[model samples]
Structure formats: C-alpha cells, structure tokens
Target: MQRQTTIKKDVSYRGIGLHSGREVSMRLLPAPADTGIVFVRTDAGGRQIHARAANVTSTLRATTVEENGVKVFTIEHLMSALHAHRIDNVCVELNAEEPPVADGSSLAYFDLIESAGIEELRSERHEIVIDRVCRIDDEATGRFVMALPYDGFRVSFISLNPHKLIGTQYEDFHIDAQTYRREIAPARTIAYEKEIDQLREMGLGLGGSLENVIVYNDEGWINPLHFADELVRHKILDVIGDLRLAGIIRGHVIAAASGHALNTALAKQIAASLG
Candidate 1:
C-alpha cells in the first residue's frame, strides 16, 4: 500500500473568481494523515468544509459547498488539481468565500503544491475502486458519463461543438501527480464571448478577464497565448474535478459531453453503491 503525504510548508496565491469576480487570497497548508481535503474560510471566522462530493449543495455555475448557509464557491479547479496530484491530505485555508482564479488553471496550485514538497505518512492510502461499470446521463443536456475498469485512474473526454475553433475535441490520459501537473495543470478555464456576456449579465464571471481565462471569438482564440490542443487539455482538467466527487474513484473513467453536474451525479450514484 502507498503512504499518505502532507506538504512541508505553507504556500499561497491571489486572484479573482471566474464567476463572482471578487478578489480572494488562499493558502495551502500541510495537514496530518486522514485529514482528507478540508477548506477553511479564514474570512468568515474560520468555517471549515470537507471536500466530499456528498456535501455539494450548489453547482449552478460552479461547484459550491454550504454548511449552515456559509458557502464556498468555484472549487472544482483546485479540487481537481489536488486529487490529480494524489495529495490526499491537506488543509486549504482561504481568506475569502472562494479560491483565487490564478490564471484560470491548476498550474498555480500545482506549483504551490510542489513547492511545499510531499512527506508520506504511515497510514495506507484508501480509494473507492470501481468494480462495475457505472454511468450517468442528462437527457435534457444530452451530457453523459461512465467509469470503467483500468489499471489506474484515467479520463477520456469529448466536447459536442463543431466550430472549427472548438469542434469535436477529445483526449485520453493516465493520471498521476507528476503527469497531471505537466500535462493538464496548465490548461486554463475558457468560454465564448457570447456566454461570457450572458454570465456577466447574471452577475457572474466578474473575475473573468482576458488575463485569467482564454476567451474564444467567432473565428478563434482571443487570447494571444493559444495552444493547438488547449481544448482537449481543459476538458481533461474538468474531468479531474468531476471525478473527485466519487470520493475517490480508483479505476479508469471514460466520459463524453459531460459537465460538472453529470460528473457529480455519477459520483453520488457510485458512492451510494459503495454501501
């Protein structure tokens, strides 16, 4: 069995929320084994929320957790980064209601997590291995997901758009701490200008600007730092956060046209079967 690990030091960053548009600061601190993933709201008298899919109460625009009406928002990217890296135990202390959207990707968190260094604990690592093929479907949105057997955790994703710029993208990858950091961590959050305007009308994406996220125009990327394969890479990052809802899915996962809602539904179903 593998051992648990905690960071050797504290690491911090600052940025705005993609939706809320509010500036936030967060710190990653090492914690003892079995701590799971905890989010501490340093802004609200230290309210702590555990990173369990079952605790998810809101996923309207982003993943959110609420305890006694105190909520933490836009947590998927950071959660994905942590789970992808296999850093199972850590205390995420935040000075706001949401984590900073640094560059709108997991890269910042990846760097902080790496800088802290990993120290293993004596306890054996635990994961909810997938023994059966489980799936979830959203008929209204036509988004679907499935988790199947594999030697290790992996993801296959496909988007349903046909535009030359963002059309029919898919990628499959094996997930390990090192591989995720180098391969997927740099993939930034993205959206179309029309969608951005709509979200902004609803008072969302306040933290979203050209600096943090990659914006797509009618013809192509509006951001200067465009990658040929960024679409697929970003999808993989989303899959990481979605599967995290499984509370530890231990096998390979294959999914297509899926989003955060479907991912969490699959997690809830798989978690239910665990009993």
Candidate 2:
C-alpha cells in the first residue's frame, strides 16, 4: 500500500485545445487525501466533476467525463501524466471544457505537475487490486484490453494500422515515473492526412497542426518519427490514463488495437466489480 498524493502548491498553464480550438487556462491545486482527482470548472460556475469511470460520457476520439451536463474532454494526456506521477488527489481548475493539446503529448502536463511538487497524504490509496483475469474486447474491430494480477503496474500494447508505413507496432513497458517521462511522455499524438477533413467535418481536430500533431499519409510521414513505435506507446499512455479512473490497480495490462472507448470500458468494468 502507498500513501495518496497531491501537489504541494498551485500551478497554472494556458494554451489551445486540439479539438475545441478554444483558448483555455487551467490550474492544479493540492487536495486532501482521498479526494481523488476532481475537475473543477471555473467557467461553469464552479461545477465539480470527479475523474472516475462512472462519470465517463464519451470516448469518441478522446476520453470525456461528464456530470449534470458539464463535460470535460481531451483529458487523457493530463490524466496520463497524473497516473505516471502516481498522483491520487488534486483539484484541476479549468476555464474551458478541455485542456490544451500541449505539443500533442503528456510532456507539458508532466512538467507542470513536477513544478507544483507532489506531497504525500496521510491516508493510504484505495487500491483496486486485480486478483483475476479481466478482459474486454471489441469483436468487430478486434480491439481488446485485459488485466491480470501483478505485483506492480505494467502495460504491454500493440498498435495496428492498415497503412503500410505503420503496419504493426508493439511495446512492453514496466511503468515508472522516470521511464514514463523519458520513454512515453514525448511521444506525440498522430493522425493521418487522409482523415483531417473528416475530423474537421465532425468538429474535431480543429487545433491540430504540424507543430503539435504528427501527420502521416500513404506518401510518408510529414513529420519525423520520435520512435518507430510511438503510436503504440501513446496508446499505452492512453490506457494508463483511462484505467486510472478505476483508481490504483495492481495489475499487468495487455492490450491490442485498443482506443479510448475500449480502455474506458475496461475501467468501468473494474470499477463496478470493485464496488
């Protein structure tokens, strides 16, 4: 068992959202033990929404949590950072519905949290131990995520893409804050050139650009690859963020072709089972 943790002081940042294209500002404040991570919407008259699986309302292209019609989207990156940092409680105050894209990776958020400094709380974390095999699969897409009993946290992922340039990528990660920051935090979000128009039509990817997003096409990658397996690593990053909604779980997760939807599905299942 480990003590819960929150930042020692308030830290703030401002940028634009990838999907919403809105200018937003956010602050991270320390919270008491067992508060978990809460999203406080300052623009919504100080509405509070807990970051948990039960509150998840959407996973279209990004993980979104909602309560009483108040929604927060594109939280995976920041949540990924929090998960990696093992932060158990914090009040995230945001002036917009979504956080900034932040170079299309978790690096910025990780740095912001580092600046705030983590403080251990008195109470131990309410850990949800995965004692048996738990699995969720999307048959049609061949997407699946599973968790098995393990002494510590780990993630093994496989990313599959129809494109020849990005056919299949695999990576097994033993997660730690240092490893996550160095190996996973810099891996940027990726999109194909072919899907840009479609995404825009769906009112998504409005703030994505060559600067923050790694755009690829059949011709080739428009940007250089940070790691040939960057996509799969980012997918693992998403898994960590999404599964953390179930609280701390002692498990080794194995996933393939999984996305926000499937990740949150597994989170919901684990959370429900624990309750």
Candidate 3:
C-alpha cells in the first residue's frame, strides 16, 4: 500500500500575488497523516480552509477557496506541487489572500518541498479511483474534460486558440514525481498580450510580468518558452493541481481548451461519484 506523506520540515517563500499585487509570505508546514492539504489565513482570525472542491469559491482566472469570510486566491500552482510530491498532509500558512506567483509555475514550490524532504506516515494513502468514464463539457465554450479508469494518474491536454501565435497544441504525459518536475513544473503560466489591459482593467494580472508568464502576441511569444508546447503542458499542470481538490485520483484525465472552471467542475463530479 502507498503510504501517506508530508514534509519533514517547514519551507517558506515570499512573493507578490498575481492578481492582488500584494506582497505575501507563505510557509508550508508538515501535518499529521490524513490531514490532507489545508490553508490557514494567518492574517484572518486563523480561518482554516480545506483545499477541496467543496470549499472552492471561485475559478475566475485562478482558483480561490473561502471559508468563514476568509478567502485564499491563486492556489493552483502550490496545490499542483503538493500533489506531484504526493504530499497527503500539509498546512499552508499565509499572511495574505494569495501565495506568491514564484515565476508563475510550480517549479519553485516543487524545489522548496523537495528541499524539505518527504516523510511517510504510518497510515496508508487512499485515492478515489475512477470506475467509469466521467466527463464535463461546455458546448458553448468548446471546452471539455474527462476522466477514465487507470492504474495511475495521467493527463492529456490540448490548447486551441484563434491567435496564430498560440495555435492548436497538444501534449500527453504520465504523472510521476520526476516527470512532473522536469516537464510540467517549469511550464510557466501563459496569457495573450491583447488581454493584458483587459485583465488589468478587470482587477487581475496586476503582478504578472514577462518574467513569470509566457506572453504571446499576434506575432509570437514575448518571452522564450521552455518547451515548444509549453502552453499545453501548463494546462496539464493546472489540471493536475485542480484535480487534487478531489483528493488523490487514480485515473487518466483528458482535457481540451479547459481552464480552472472546467477543471474544478470535473473534480467535483469525480468526488461526487466516489463510492
């Protein structure tokens, strides 16, 4: 049986929130077995929000979880790192509403967790294994996500954009610690140049920069890409993190042009189907 795991020591970081544009400090602390991942709002009245789909309050541009009037924002990257490391229990303490952007990828979080090391618990890890095909589709938006029974976690993703700079792209990979760190963790979040002003006007992407995000224009990528299909790879990375909201899932996930909304929706469906 797979053992539940948590970090051996505390790991901390400081950075700016992608949308909030506020400086924040966060620390990941090891927790007891079966604790799962929980976010502690240190700035609030110590509100605790379990990192699960049931607590998710918003998926607009980023994932946010709220409990008792306290909300945590843009947590997908950190969540993805914990999931990749197979960390079943952790308490993420933060002094702000969001975690640091940290190059807009999970790479920094992965490194921090690796440095802290993983400790196995006496309890065995449990996962919600998909027994049948489950799907979530947005016909109007042309977005789709589905899960199928599989022995281990895997993700296949496709990104389709009208912009020539970010045309159709596809990638598939099995979810393992090494593979995730090398391939998916470093894939930075992506956005369109044309949408920058719109996003800022909507009070989002204020902390975004070329250093942390892959900006694409009608011409091409504003910043260098780590992989040719890094955009699609990042999409898969987000899916991996979002699905963790359902706890560990032993299944294969396939997504097309899906973002946080659809990703979390699929997670809710899988969680509800669990028996």
CA deviation > 4 Å runs, candidate 3:
none
lDDT digits (tens) for residues 235-275 of candidate 3: 98899999999988888999999999999999888888882
What are the per-residue Cα lDDT tens digits for candidate 1 across 63-152?
887775578878888888878777878898888888988898888887888888888888877777888998998888778888887778
The CA lDDT of each predicted structure is 0.80, 0.92, 0.91
Better by TM-score, candidate 2 or 1: 2
lDDT of 2 by residue, 169-274 (tens): 9999889899999899999999999999999999999999988899998899999988888888889889999998998777899999999999999999999997
Cα misplacement distance, residue 224 of candidate 1 (Å): 3.2
Put the candidates in lDDT order, highest first: 2, 3, 1
- Each prediction's RMSD to truth: 1.6, 0.9, 1.0
TM-score of 3: 0.98
In angstroms, give how far residue 65 of model 1 lies from its true place.
1.6
In candidate 3, which residue pairs get closer than 3 Å at backbone N, Cα or C atoms, i.e. clash?
Answer: none
- How many angstroms is residue 235 displaced in model 1 relative to the true structure, after the best TM-score fit? 1.7
